[model samples]
Target: MHQLLSRTFKPTFLKIYNESHLHNQKLGRETHFRVVIVSHEFNTISPVKRERLVHKSLEHELQAGVHALSVIARAVDEPLDTHTSPPCQKPVV
Candidate 1:
């Protein structure tokens, strides 16, 4: 996933936070992610378009096993948020 994003987005800053353990699941399982991407590629795009671009890059993982995914895609000059994320709604197994 990281490699894919790197190749596709060419972000100046990339952060992939694995939040799978915080969900309702067994320990050490990786199914959810919080990604912070800063890229010049996003400079001319809207927020929705940024999400679409990211989803397009990770389509197969979302279909295969990833239960929840959240992203903060920003342009190189944009500011990042420092607030906390809400609870995950992971599926019941």
Candidate 2:
């Protein structure tokens, strides 16, 4: 999956988190992911577009088995800010 994203976006820095442990999943299984992608491709792009680009790149994996993907796509020139999300409200099915 990292290979796919790297090839597609050519990110300067990419970090992928397997966050299945935060839900009802076994260790080492892939069902939820958080992606921190920094790339020149996102320069000046809107948040929605960044998400769209990422989603498009991971379309196959999302369809195959990845239940959730929390994307934090950033531009190389963008300012750094702490990103936080509310805990999962719905129980993992």
Candidate 2 weakest ten by summed lDDT? 80-89
Q: What does candidate 2's lDDT look like per residue over 1-93, in tens digits?
A: 899999998999898888887776899889998888999989989989998989999999999999999899889988755365456667559
RMSD of each: 2.7, 2.4
Best TM-score goes to which candidate?
Answer: 1
TM-score (all chains, Cα) for each model: 0.89, 0.86
Pairs in steric clash, model 2: none
Scanning candidate 1 in windows of ten residues, the lowest lDDT window is 82-91
Candidate 2 segments whose C-alpha is farther than 4 A from its true place: 82-85, 90-93
Please give the lDDT score for candidate 1.
0.88
Give the per-residue lDDT digits (tens) of candidate 1, residues 1-93.
Answer: 999999999999898888887887688888988888999999999989998899889999999999878989999888987345688666779
Error of 1 at 57 (Å): 0.6
